[model samples]
Target chain A: MTRIAVSLLYAGALVVLIALPQLISVKYYLHLSILALIWLIVSQGQNLIQGYTGYVSIVGAGFMGIGAYSTTLMGMHLGLPVWLTILLAPPMTAVFALIVGYPSLRMKGHYFAIVTLAFNLVIFIVLLNFTELTQGEAGITGIPKPAGWLEALNFRDREVYYYFVLAVAVLTTGIAWAIVRSRVGQILMAIRQNEDLVGALGVAAWKYKLFAFVASAMFAGLGGALYAHYQSFINPEVFGVAQSLDAILAVIVGGSGTLAGPMIGAFIVIFLPEYLRFADSFRLIIYGLLLVLATIFMPRGIVGLAQDLGARIAGRR
Target chain B: MIEILQQIVNGIAIGGVYVLIALGLTTVFGILGIAHFAHGSVSMFGGYLTFFLVAGQGIPLVIAIPVALTAGVVLGMAIELLAYRPVRKASHINAFIVALGLTMMVEGLNLEFFGHEQVVIPTSFDRVFNIGGVTLPELRLYVILAAALLIAAMTIFVERTKTGQAIRAVAENRDAAILMGVNVRTIPLVVFAMSTALGVAAGIMVGALFAIAPGIGEGLVIKGFAVLILGGLGSIPGAIVGGIVLGITESLAAGFVSSAYKDVIAFLVMIFVLLFRPQGLLGKAS
Candidate 1:
C-alpha cells in the first residue's frame, strides 16, 4: 500500500508485459494479448463513467463502432495515412458522444441506462442497415495496417502489433489515471454518490456527468480505432451491445473504480471464453452464473476482494 | 387509405404484445422498484417451453400453454427469492446488474434447451376477415382479443382485489404498507407471479403470431422498456397506451418508410419523447 510498493508493483507489471511476447510459446496467445490490451483501453474508459461516475453507459461498443468506422472510412475514401485516420477517430467519436450524452445525461439511474442502451441498438441498426456506408454486415475487410510509418518493424507481425498496442494501452491508462486523480474525477464521484446533494451545493452535476460520458466515449473510440487497425477487419458485429456488456463485465469483475481492475478484467473477459471452450454448450450459462455470483458475492470485484483480504491480514499481523 | 388501415391493424397486434411485456415490466418496477430486465428472456423461456411441449412432444396447444404459464409463475418466484431478494438492501445499481446477469442466464438457458433456431407455435387459426376495406387475419384478431382480455383482467384484479390494493400501497410506500399490516414479504412473490404470468401470455402470443428466436427476447425487452418510457415508467395506463402507440409507430414506419430502419425510427421517437416530455405521456410531471 506504500508508494514504493505501488511503484514497484507497476514496474514489475511493466516488465512482465514487455517480456510477454517473447515468453509465450503460442502466437495465438499473443493475438489474444493484443486484443486484451485494446480492451484494456476501453475498460479504462468504461471505469471512468460506470465505475467512478456511477452511470452505466451501454453504448461503449457503439462509440467504438463509430470510431472504427470513422477510422476505416476516412482512410479508405480520403486517402489519408492510417495514423492520421486513427488520430481523428477519437474526435470524430466525440462529436457523436456529445450529441448522445447531451440529452441522455439529463436522466439518472435506470432511465439513463435504458436510454443509452437504445442508443447502442440504434448505432448497431445504422451500421447494419446503412449498407451503402457500412457494407451491411458483410463488413469492411482488407484494412490497411500502420505499416509505412513503422517500416523498421513489420506491423503485421503479431508481436510488433502487441507491443504497439501495449504502448497505447499504457498511455491511455495513464490518461485515465490522471483524470481519476484530478478535480473532475472528484466531482464525478460526488455526482455518483448523490447528484442532488452536489446540485444543492451549487455544482453543475450534469456538466461533470457529461464530461465523464464524453471522455469515456473518446476512450472507446481510441480502442475501436486500434482494434480496426490491429485486426485489419472492421465489422459492426464485433461492436454491438454484447461487447458493451463485456466491457461492463470487465469493469465489474476486475474491480470498479480502481486503476488495476480493468487491466486484470479486460484479460479475463477476453480469455475466459477461450478457456471455457471445453464447455462450449454451457459457456453462456456459466458466464451468466459467474456474472450473477460476482455481482452478489464479489460486488467490489477482484481488486476489492484482494484489498479486503490484505487489510485483514495486516490486522491479524 | 386501406393500406394505412391495414398497417394500423398490424401495429395493434404487435402493440398488444408490447403492452403485455411493458405491463409485466411496469408492475415489478412499480411495486418492487426492480427493472427486471430478464422479464423478456423469461417470457421467451415460457414460449419455448410451450413450443417444446406442443411441437417436440405430443401435448395439445391448449394444454401446453397453461403448463407453461404455471411454470412461468414458478420461475418468476424463484428469480425474486434467489436472484433479486439477496440484493434488496444493496444499491439500485446492484439490482440492475443482477437483472442483467439473470437476463444472460435465462437467455443462455433458452439457447441450451431450445437450440438456436427460431420456433413458431403452430395453430389451426387459418381464417381471414375482410372489413369494409382493410383485412384482418384470424390469428392477429385472436392475439388482439387475448391481449385486451388480459389487460382488462389485470385492471380489474388491481382495482378490485385486496391483494392488488396491498401492491399499490407497497409501491406508494413500503414502510407505510408494512405499518398498515400488509404482508410485505409475500407481496414481491405475488407481483413476480402476476408479472411473469403476463409475460408468459405475451411470449405465447409472440410465438403463435410471429416467431420466437434467440435474440428476439432481448429486442422485445428493449421495446418493452421503450414503451415504459413512452407511457411513464410506473403508470399502468401509460404502459398500455405507450405499447399501442409504439407498435403502431413501428408498423406505420415500416409500411411508409424503410422496413430496415423501423427500429431506428422507433428509438428516434423515444429519444425525442425523452427530450420534449421526460415525464412520459401519462407520467406525473415531477
Candidate 2:
C-alpha cells in the first residue's frame, strides 16, 4: 500500500538525516543544516496557523524572540538549567499570544496580518528600548549552552547539535502530521475553506483560531529557545518582521497548505542563498526575483508542483 | 505652548509625507482591492532614482524630479500588467503573495542599485524663519506647501477629470462601470501610475527632508497601512485626516513620552482608535 511506502520513505529520510553530518563532515554544512532544522520547527508552527487555519500570523519571530530571551536570561541570571528554561519558555511565550490573540483575532484576514505585524514591532521596540533588561541592542552574548545530562550529550560538538536538532525536527513534524490527520485538522481546513460554514455547523471559529494561534506560539517559542542556545547570543533584530517574512517565504515556496511543504521550504529558504554565494552582494536580488516569479508562475509551491507532476506520470501508466 | 506649537509644526511636515504615502496606497486599495505592499519600495525607488539623477549625474532637481515621476508611472504600469494582471481572477492571496514578492524584489533592486548608504538629496532651502515664538525652517515650510499643492492637484484631477470619474466608477462598482461603457481595464494602470507618482513625490520629500536608505520603505509602508486603517480603507479624505493624526500623534508621543519607542506609540494609538471605532475614523460602518 501507499501508506507503507510513505512510512518507509519517512524512515529512510530519518536515517539519512541522522547520518547527514557524518557523511558531509563539513562543519559549514552542519551549521547550515542546524539552522534549517531550527527554521523547520518555527515554520511548522507557522504552517499550522497560516497554512491550515488560514490566519497569517506574522508575529512568529516575536514569540521566538520571547522564548530566546526567556530561556537565555533565565539560564544566565537565575542559574536554572537551560533544559528547564526551554521547557518553561514556550508556555510563557504562549501566554503573551493569548493576550495578543484575544484582541487581534477579532479582526479578519489582512487586518489580523497587520495587527500581528504591529505586535512584532511592539516586541522589537521593547527589546531595544528596555535597556536594563535586554541590554539595549548590544545583545546578550556568551549565552550558556544546555547543562547537566543535556550537555552530557556533548552538544558543543556541531555534529551532536545536528542530531539534537534533527530529533526535535522529527518530533515537531510528527506532532504536526498527527494534528493534520486528526479531527482538529479537519475543522481547521474547513475553516480555511469557509469559516462561515464551520461556524454555521456550530464550530466557534474564534476558539479554534485561538487554539491554533497558541499552538503556533509554542512552536515559535521552542524554536527560539533552541536557536538562542545554539547560536550562543540573542538580539532584538533577530525577531523583526524580516525573520517572519523568511518563515512566510519558506511556507509559500514549499507549499503552504501541505504538511510536506514547510520541510522542503526550510531547505530552499536556507540553502538557495548558500548555494548562490557566488552572486555575493546580488544574492537577495535573485532571491527576490525568485519569490515574485514563484508566486506568479507556481502559486501552488514546489510540493504542489511535484504532486501535479506525479499525478500526470501515474495517470500516463 | 511654544513647545507644543513647535511639535505640531514638526509633526505636520512628516504628516505631509504620510499623506502622500497614504494617497498612493489608498488609490490601489480603493480601486483594485490590492494592498500593494510594494508601493513603499516603489516610492523609495523613486527617491533613489531622483538622488541618482541629481546627486550622481549632476542634474538639476527640477529635471530629476519629473524624470523620476515619469519612471514611477511607467514602473507602476508595468507592475499592474506584469505582476498583478494574471492573478486578477485568482484568490486574493495570490495578489498578497505578489505584493510580498514585489516588495522583496524592489527592495532587492534598490539595494543592488543604490547600495546601503543613506543619501540625503541636497537642497539649498537652508533659510530658517522664526515666526512669533515658534521657529519654522524654510525646508519644512516648502515640504508642507508642496504636500498641500499635490493634494489639491490630486483632488481636482479625481473630482473633475473624465478618467478620474471612470476610475471612481470602477471602484464604486466594477461590473456596473463595465456596463456603463467605462474601460475598467485601464483604471488599474491609471491608478497605479497616479499612486506611484504620488509616492514618488513623497519619496522626494522624504529624501530632501530626512534621508533615504535600505529598509526605510518597510516602515513607510507600515505607516501608510496604519493611515489607511486610521482614515478608513479606500477613503482619500480619511487618508489625509488619518495621516495627519498619526503624524501628530507620533510627534507628541516622541516629544513627551519616549522617542525610542516613537513607532510603537503610533501603532498603539491606532489600536486604541480601533478599539473604539472598528471601521476606522471615517470608514463606513457596515
Query: Model 2: per-residue lDDT, tens digit, A209-300?
Result: 89889988999999999999999989999899989888887888899988778988988888988987898877776777778789888888
Tell the DockQ for candidate 2. Answer: 0.64
Task: Using TM-score, give the best candidate's number.
Answer: 1
What lDDT does model 2 reach? 0.88
User: On residues A110-148, what C-alpha lDDT tens digit does candidate 1 reach at each position?
Assistant: 788889999999999999988999898999998898865
Interface RMSD of each: 1.0, 1.4
TM-score of chain A of each: 0.98, 0.96
What is model 1's C-alpha RMSD? Answer: 1.2
RMSD of each: 1.2, 1.7
Give candidate 2's TM-score: 0.97
lDDT of 2 by residue, B50-165 (tens): 99999999999999999999998898899999988877875666677788878887888898899999999998899999998999999999999999999989988888999989
